[model samples]
Target: MGFVCNGRYVLEPAAADEAEKYVNLLHDCMEETYSAIADPGFMVRRRAARDESIEEFMEEVNGPGVRCFLAYEVPRWTSQGGLSCAVGADIEWDAPVGLALSSLGPHEWESEMPVVPVVAGTRDLSQLYTRATTHGTGLGEALLRAVLADDEPAYLWYIGGNERAKRFYEKFGFQDEGIFGECGGIWGVPHGEPGQPLQTARMFRGGVVLQ
Candidate 1:
């Protein structure tokens, strides 16, 4: 079951109808985080590309072994007709404020760095984003915990120069393994200026054993 965090946000698995909304929320968060680093025109093109690939994205997220979680801000309670309304009665959830997406699969790096044998069981965190306004409300951690609550062998990548993201993952004991490359080379999309490419670095946490 999904849970509430900070008494103001509810975290739960994304529903089937949320695919498009998830994409919109994802880009909103990306714009907030990477607008300074990404070329303005590139961002526009990427948005178009994402729109065209919505179906693909949905398929991947809903694919077997994948887990996607969404977090919504809790609305305030109201009284009606001199009666307090039930918390879950007709409550409308605004667009999601946060998302965490992960999948269990063989470890694979999308860069030219020599490929390594795939681990039998690896949970790769594909995406995580929270609107800037939701920062510090405990929404991000709640989303993260939904996907990865243990110190398992897992991996993820973060855009270069995102110190806030770096610190957050570090708090979870994920270490940078010195792997670095252009974002486009790894993701097959021009997420930054060709003149000054957006770089990404991988972080990994390897501990604890699967039962």
Candidate 2:
């Protein structure tokens, strides 16, 4: 099923190749959005993953437990180039992205506390740039609704410093679980300065059913 918001866009499951595009699109989105808020170099170093080929990225994406979806235009173009949004769930294990961030000690948490018993999901809403220019609209809320349609308890980590993102996540009923220390360096932030810490907030949605 798909949702058309404002009469110009649709949200649907992303095709395989389309999923790859969304990854690249996210890279671009991070570049643009982060640059506007922080230094350009900071954005590139922190959010853009380097040295991985598209095929490798795709393989990583298709690995066990990963699912992705996209929000595109109604009349799909040859390019299918519109806002490419995605949500990935790491079911039984943590994602590579998650693992890498956790490896950087000092900020890492020691948990006798097992991994949170919940699905972890991430939605790339910043990819709406192309569609935004064409339609003068944004479907972040729509895409988010689609991503959360499963009704399972899910969570995402937001860079503690990004107020805008924190606000966005709150609109979806997410609340802070705790500071996800050393976790925000997913894309390699405070680059090359290994010990530099980034703050993270673990936000959750849906309530636990007592059954």
lDDT of each candidate versus the true structure: 0.70, 0.44
lDDT, candidate 2, equals 0.44
Model 1: residues with Cα > 4 Å off, grouped in runs = 77-86, 106-120, 185-195, 208-211
Superposed Cα deviation of residue 182, candidate 2 (Å): 2.2
lDDT of 2 by residue, 1-211 (tens): 3534543454445444644455555565555445544433554563345435355545644544444455555443222433332112112211101000011111123232223433222322212223224322446655555545545455566655677667766777777776565543343345555344445555666763211
Model 2: lowest-lDDT 10 consecutive positions: 94-103
Q: So what's the TM-score on candidate 2?
A: 0.58
At residue 73, candidate 1 shows an lDDT of 64
Residues 88-149 of candidate 1: C-alpha lDDT, one tens digit per residue: 53434657888899886543445344334335567878889999997976777778878886
Model 2 segments beyond 4 Å from truth? Answer: 1-3, 36-40, 46-57, 63-65, 74-138, 184-186, 189-197, 208-211
- The lDDT leader among the candidates is 1
Q: After superposition, how far is residue 85 of candidate 1 from its true place, in Å?
A: 10
